[model samples]
Target: MIDEHATPDLLELAARYGVSREFVDWRGRLTTVSASTLIAVLRALDVDASTPDAIRSALGDTELAPWRRPLPASIVQRAGDTPWIFVHLPHGAQFRAWAVLEDGSTRDIPQIDNWIDPREVDGVLTGRATIVVPADMPRGWHELFVAITDDGATERIARCPLITVPERLNTAAANDETKRFGIMAQSYQLRSNTSWGIGDTRDLGALASWGARQGASFVLVNPLHAPAPVEPIEPSPYLPTSRRFRDPLVLHLDVIPAVQLLEGPDAERFATLSRRATALNATPTIDRDVVWRAKREGLELLFDYDLKDPVRKRAFGMFCEREGQELVDFATYCALAEEFGADWRAWPQALHDVSGQAVSEFRDTRADRVEFWRWVQWLTEEQLLEVQRSACEAGMSLGIMHDLAVGVHPYGADSWAMPEALARGVSVGAPPDMFNQLGQNWSQPPWRPDRLAELGYKPYRDMLRAALRCGGALRIDHILGLFRLWWIPEGQTPDAGCYVRYDVEAMLGILALEAERAGALVVGEDMGVVPPETRDTLAHFNIDGTSVLWFERGMSDEPLAPEHYRAHALASVTTHDLPPTAGYLKLDHVRLRHELGLLEVALEDEIQRERATIEEVLDTLRARGALASAASSVEEHTLALHRYLASSSARLMGVSLADLAGDTRSVNQPGTHREYPNWCVPLGNGSGERVTLEQVIASEWAVTLLEASRR
Candidate 1:
């Protein structure tokens, strides 16, 4: 029986748009999306479903929208497979179809006869003709060109983007027989004596070198994506202003070549600023505003230094030319954010449109400021390249593995520059699960699936290219999002949202293609409320999935044995969302969640259940001889947990830098924002003392655990 709130027509329209009417929740209970929620979500996708007449009209348009287009806006296929496209034209009309390769070559596409009835539109007959693409076409971005004529006179011409991607990702480790381990850390949380407050690429280079000496294979860090250019920047890396560019705040000034140009008061001011920022390392929390202000001032001084060398100028020109208009657009957004507030919506109406005359005039008038931002990105990228080089030189099989966040802030640069690519009036989040009973609203806008296809997934491709350019591997956060996202309507609670599906094949294909181009590895974060077939698909594409020690369970809800762990996974004992191994041993997650009012049940009961799960895992570890029966110390338990992970068939094992340093606090909490000071927490030892990267390298616990994992 159907709910009274949703009419049959409304349900049909929602289904046509890939919106779910009912789905199983995390708790294995069936939940129906309300009609009001459906209408709001449908409105977000630019469909009208508020009234019966609107639903009927949308249903009709949905049926004919494909027929109206001569060819679909885009076509994506595997490199080795032939893809067919349907072209619509006046009944019995003649047309020529061909593909223009990315290298400027052309190929004739032959037509195939597939039986389909003709439809009349506006008293004119229309037929759909199938055309076959050559399987031997080069794997790159190309275009399908169609010409329709009447009596040899060209009537219409249309073009569609053709993306030929790899059948499987390039993962060297997938074929290697050896098991490798790496250090996972939040890039900003890592501090060193040389860093000005927050961690820099230089710190990452040092950490990677040290880890390599300890027989590590890689260093996985948090997203280095840019935040708002203004003060009071959003602290969470997952909520970046733009995912397509790196944040300049992480640039280490001392190592930058431009810093050598400063003299007199400018040099003295830079030194004083650097000292003040370095003093921030002694504190327990990261003041990002103070850090950015100091870094921005230092960057401006460097930007002001004149470049008299022709070679340097040419290098800068080459970078700008290579980046092209996308870099220009991002830089322009940064400059405008400085003048107007960070939120583009609050800016003058004319400036809101990134391509409009007003914004163009603004860019022309404030060209210097825009250039300054662009130069900063170039500098940041230069340092990033050095860090990766150092990692590889240190003998890392996979160097710095960058993380890709799931979405972007609704009011940030990406949304401002490409408004059509993002959906309006809705945010991305998760429904209720075992840990987060109340659900979560991330406040980040979901990508518009339809628009992304129409635009040929350029935005997505650009982001992946930038992320993989200098890294050996990339970890996609919340990779489940590629298949479907939970869409929460504006002003609605997260539980009221419904799932919206995407073109998963296209998304995964493009990701694999980019990774293949860069010769990098891909690890998908496939945790939390995942569909059963999602992991299979990831493995089919040679993309590794994430597996945590505490979450692995068997049919009886007991901890899984080491041999049962997935081989194509990045196995870890702990994650950033949870406390380090030492803290988890003390039941910190349960206690903290209880204190934050994030628990639906009684705190004691939750703690009891958690303790029971921990005991079961410990028992398994002891039975496997990974832990001694008499081992009761936190350090012993932590080491034993990792030793257990080392025994797994998992191709890659990730050791958290926090755990290695004996850190007891979590770098992030899942549900709460301001209540817990989430991403601001600095790296510390068990005694809660702030430690620099140099000190962490010399830490006894870190050394011992790393050695144990290697053995």
Candidate 2:
């Protein structure tokens, strides 16, 4: 039932706009969205529904809005399924339209639908024309152009974006339909001999090379999305200032081209800084701020150095040209953040608008600083491209699978850049579940669904394009967000939140288009309390789902049989949210939960429940003949669990680097910020010894694990 305050017209308008009035909650009970929440969310969408009369007016505006535009901003058609676009024209108007292909070719499109009676829209007599796309139209982001004639004269020209999407994505591996396996590790924690205290793109390149040699098909990594470039640097890769850029901290100073140009004293100082970083590498914790500070000082010298190689300079200039205004906007934010603070909302009013007169004046004064920031982005892009290029050269099918975080930080560049497109009063979050009764508020702003559609989903498309440009595969952090998101109003607890629906068809279609274009695989993290139809819908889009060994159980006490696992899923023994396989066997998660006071039940009860769960896993592994050793050491348990994962029918298998090293610690534990050192832990083996990538690559243990993975 709709809320009492919402009239029939208001409810209809909300439904038409994809706003949910009620939904089944986590408890499987009918939950109604509060009236205040709906009104606030509507207002955030720029829908004027403040009163019943305003609701009627908004509905009228919505109906006539399409007529105001010559054509919708975007049109999506399936690869082989023909679809028509409705065109609005003044009465007695004639138009000839055609689609411009990516290769600069054009295909003429014809109007298929019969004429319709002219209707008055905003005092204009608008008639409808249906343009039908050919069934065999190639899939791509094409442009549509129309020459219009009205009042016996042809003068007006209209253009719009035409997106042809594949009904389902088929990755390169899917062509052969053979099962593939890869290694999953936190990119930041993967230390190497050449790294500057923390892992860098060079380390990623080394790991990819070694993993390919070990028969791995891909190297999945944590989100490398850039954090704020300042002291008090962010540690978690998941919380990035801008998902579109890479942090300069991940650059290997020795490998940068400009570093070669450093003269006598500068070269010596750079080496000194590099050696200083070496001292921090041996520690068990990764201090991102310290690492960034050291790298920043060295990079600043390179930033000031003039270029001698015209070839490299031209390439950098082309990159800047290709990136266009987005790069400029991001660089401007970075330059301003350096002067102001990380939170753009806290900046002075004169510097608040990124494109305003005041900001332009600031840009003129700080042109050098802005250029320096853009140069940093170009440098990262160079390194990232090389890392992926190395992986593919090393013969991996899907090289350097990048992780995409669910959302950007609340006060970061993205939020400040697109204030109107992002919801302000509500933050992305989750409802109260059995594991977390208090619920969760991620503090990341949710995208305004209405605004996203109005913009023809350019923001989402641009993000996917950036993510896939340098990688063979992309792992969407929280894939469920495409369907719906739990939005918690600001200044309120998550319990008061409600689920807001999204335009999933449009979203998924665009994802398919981008994936097809880049020849990249897409894996969605569709774990943890998913809706019943989610897996099915994802399968329809050919987006692979994740299957963790720990949670792959049916209604009974036994684990789900390996053969019963979904064929389209990526089977893995553990994920970043859990303790590494070895630590999971040791029940380290339970202890950590208890330490964080995250356990709601009595500690003993929790332990007992975990005991039963672990027993079930061991029993199933033994029954399936997956266990090789009689002794129940951490390494043996991890290998056995991985063997079970390999036995699955799932197309992709992911083995953790930590599991191979026999590490018993978690890289990240949910529900804790600074409480448990979430994303800053170093990679350690089962023997409780931290190991660098060089050690791990050559270790016999990794070879043994790779054998199991291949089996």
Candidate 3:
């Protein structure tokens, strides 16, 4: 029945959709596709009049035909009564309805005829449907599943998952009335007098004791997300192999009881590595690969001893049980990837697909290696918990505030584990904006919104639960992606990308539910071309927005005064991407950008003008008596700016450690990777020396900033 010769060439189709041929071939024929390509092909076939509204409607209706519907606004029931449910459908489509009880039994509800018709309301198609259940339905908990039935077929066209009822809200509000603030740190930066190259948990515990003395609430850390199992590893936290597990490189080897029992040459090797590690802490810049390699070699020596430890073995069992099959699959993938290479596609045919028999055989054959990977995760988790406990014992109101990256690496374990959820042929990126004229291609696979909806957002919910487990609060990077994202086809320029929309209602609902459950506050990084309604939506859910100093400006070419800062936002002088306060004041960032070839002629001139304007604003602050007369030098001016920011009406503030020490280099350079040495700079010592972790916290600048902030 198939005509192989008539089929479109994969490369030609990829060109038509502006995607990579590899992504197309991976999906196996033209039936399945990445969301970006699917949408592009639909437009190519439609030949409709290209109005913005028409394009959006077509994209929403056609590309998402398999997954689109509306559900009831809320489900309500009295205690010890049968739950009553209601739903408002988008159009009058025959639906197969079922109530999934707490016991996992699905009871079908007979459908009624002609529910509701879609009408043009405010220039948009709007439809409604409502269904109420009997008062004597069931007593416990339940959920509703609604599926649109296809003509003459038992199969459903679209399905939506909805909460049937709630028993109670279990999370309690914080009893303390004190405001909280947190700092993000690198584990290697926390050094002790006995530390081997970088800071360890012992140093972190010491810092926690110091933070308590200063009345600080918490200390956030960079993604402790596990790095690759291989050597010459990816150092960027944003490009982790597994976001679910903590990196073993940060583990304090001395704390492990089994390490003391080792003997012979293996023990001597451990001693030599320990001494080298201690020396590494005194060095500038974290050598992640070297640190991890040392830790791994030391860990391998203790592997046999760890297997005999009953308590450790039990802990490992508990961890495996808690994580379920996903953890095993991730670790298995990591071990195999290291042996093969980072890319899964390049692996042997049998091992290529994680769900196949070849992977199962491999797992059975390499059970010890699998268990070793699991043990590493368990130890990492244990240490991270210890760090949190230390923070709480130090009188911190919030233990740690973790950051959730926008997306995961394309070739990483997450993508391999859940290929169905990810868009294979597309890369997540930003559209061309004023700051980044060329736009950005992050090379990270985005979640297929439709597939996620079909699966009731189980994967997303799990990710959020894992991220929120150890943190008091979580910062969602690129929070706007929850509503919509710009999906650039693999081989296309960012300008060729189109916006793919998400169900904002469902996304907000899930977020609110998670935050309520965790008893945690949510902060959204709501920067860059945010939709007009985004702020209002965030406000409705009590989510805090981010406000940075450089972007704050009034309508009449006036600088946004300190008083104008929003009450429900985190007001900061600068973010990780921007220049530190000292760098901005001295215009070092401009020169850095030029060196990285990120600055063009027009933008370079514009930056200079902005710098002049900033200086003028600082002068105005001095003239108005807002700033002290001592704020004459650039260093003093930078400090005054921070003081003004701290005194703002915003509920939260973030003071970068880089700014405290006048560190000129940025943690990340937006445009270039190899051309720029990003995420490698250490906090400066102000004496033209790169400061050690101990020196950073003990600096006069750090002390002054802390004192001023408390006031």
Candidate 4:
């Protein structure tokens, strides 16, 4: 319940900033946000809403904000829609508006009627002038220039960035009606004999090739976003250090040209590291720290050799030039992390800001280390592109569909470099949901909605561009965040959070623009706590949704029929958050949650509920002729589940490699960090024995299940 003492002024201020005062909870109960929580969230957005006077002042600011500026921060619109742009100026001042196109051409914007008078702002009389943009304007990045004339004298000109995007993104293939199947794998868990303890681009390429051979059209992998450059790296890809860059750790060293030039001693040293790292494949859990230590030594050797080659140096320079300052800041952060520590907050205050002189000097002084990180990124880009090329050549229609994590680590490169781009005292999270009643705090900073519009969404656009660079498709994890994010105030429980809304029109417009430019398909992980109209909006943008078989229920809470499934979605039997199909059938997730103390109810009660759910799904499959009434084996059930997915009208089907190998371990367990080894489970068999990539691909069980998916 909200604080009884909260005044209407405070509630109005919160509403003005797009904050939700009350929301329906997972239990269908209306929950009002506490006044304190609202104040804290407002403060995080740089609004001083602690007192009545403060609330009044903030409310005034929000209304006068647009009038104070001559032109808006940015204008984003769909290609065919012609929108009116308001130009603010001193009363009686004349202004002319035009657009500087992306190709250096210009278009005149006509003035329109504006009867509403602007109020006095800061004691200066201001008036709004309406400008009608041409409907035939090209779809690209352009600049809107507004020049104001006062008393027949030319005043200063204001410029605003403008973008026109396609009306909706389309399916990756020309034929949108056709259904396609793909294989989903945790990238690092798919180790091979040639891997250096973790799966690399080589392994991913191999998987893509194998999937193509199985009549698959794509391979979906975990987010390959960069982690901490030094040791003690974060294991979960969902909590990446930077979303704007690729993780160099996933690069295949054998593909680097510099590796071929190693001398006798250098070769032996690299071989020793490779041999030691490859031996890690026999281990049950992935040790990223151990893998990094060995791989780093070899990477340094390659970096040194590449520096000496003129052609390689030129290629690196071109890459740097193309990446610009964002790449430099990431490399500088990595170098600084290696010198001091991964946490930038603990460093000296002068070194905290990437733009500060102290950090610039550190980059100049530790030039070699900074260059090494840049070189690593270049190698990563090369290998990822090569893998995509290989996948396409091997007959995969969509090739690799890359996963994009929702946000960056709170103390990672993005936060350290561009602190203003994200909120300071809030974390992105979910309100209490059915799975975890305590809710989930991802510990990642949410982008400041106000700042995103002010900056013309450059940070968001840059990160999306990077994720879509080398993949045929990109999956936006927690895509609902683009419209509204649950903002949990610092030092408070996740349930104390309120929803903060974003400009969905602008966000989706930019997304459509980027995806169209990349010629990639977009899939939104719209699974949990989604707003009622979110799917409709996503579908309008032609962005696909996610559908996990177990969660798709009908009005009676029974399994949804295959024909009832969404046609514009990526359907799968299970996701990384849940156990494999075999493990799910055996109630492994319920048992694991009970063991981790994450279950709200008794273990037996939870187990009984889970069993009922599985039985209901089996009944649906049996009715559809995809399963036998007497079938009891895990393999049989897994195939039946695949058959159920195949019978659906979903445009894309994803089969997890874990299910193919009969791996029982959950890739991740929500709400448990150290208690359960999240994101560390290697691909293995039912007996808990480690299975190599080749073995998983060649397994008869894998072939049989894949054949079922193609039905």
Instruction: Go through the candidates in order and give the clash count of each.
Output: 0, 1, 13, 0
In candidate 4 the C-alpha lDDT for residue 272 amounts to: 92
Candidate lDDT (C-alpha), each = 0.90, 0.83, 0.66, 0.89
lDDT score at residue 393, model 1, on the 0-100 scale: 96
- The ten-residue window of minimal lDDT in model 3 covers 21-30
Q: What is the lDDT of residue 523 in candidate 2?
A: 90
C-alpha TM-scores of all predictions: 0.98, 0.94, 0.81, 0.98
Per-residue accuracy of model 4 over 1-711 as CA lDDT, tens digit each: 234466898888989888989887877788898899899999999999877778888988988999999988889968888899889999988888889999999998899887777679899999888997788888888899988999898677999888887789854552266899999989998899999889999999999999899999999999999998888989999999999998878977777788888999999998898889989988879999999998888999888887789988998899999999999999999999998889999888999978889999999999988889988898888889988999999999889999999899999899998898999899998997878878999999999988888887899999999999998998999999999999999999888899999999989889988898888899999988886799999989999999999999888878898888889899999999999988899998988888888878999998888898898889888887889999999888888889888989898999999988889999899988899999999999998899999998889889888999993
Residues 500-589, candidate 1, lDDT per residue (tens digit)? Answer: 999998999999988988889899999989988999999999999999999999788878888888988999999888999999999988
Clashes of 4: 0
The C-alpha stretches of model 2 lying farther than 4 A from their native spots are: 1-10, 115-117, 304-306, 555-557, 628-631, 686-689
Residue 40 of model 3: what lDDT? 50
Span of 10 residues, lowest total lDDT, candidate 1: 304-313
What TM-score, to 2 decimals, does candidate 3 have? 0.81
Tens digit per residue, CA lDDT, model 2, 1-711: 334576778778777777778877667888787776777667767787778778888998888888898888677777888777888888888899999987789999988966678899878888989888898888787888888899888569988878788888876744446788999988888888778889898888998898898888899988888888877888878888888787787888887778878999998999899998978889879999889889988888887663457887788789889988888888888888888989988899877777789888887899988888888889888889999999989999888898999888888888877776788878887776765667777878888887786676788888899899889899998898899888887788887877778878888999988888788889999976578898999989988899988778776736898999988888898899888877877788888888888787887888889888887888888877887537477777767777778878999999988877778888887777778888888988776678988888888988898888883
Clashing pairs in 2: 662-686
lDDT of 3 at 453: 66
- Candidate 3 residue-wise lDDT at 9: 34
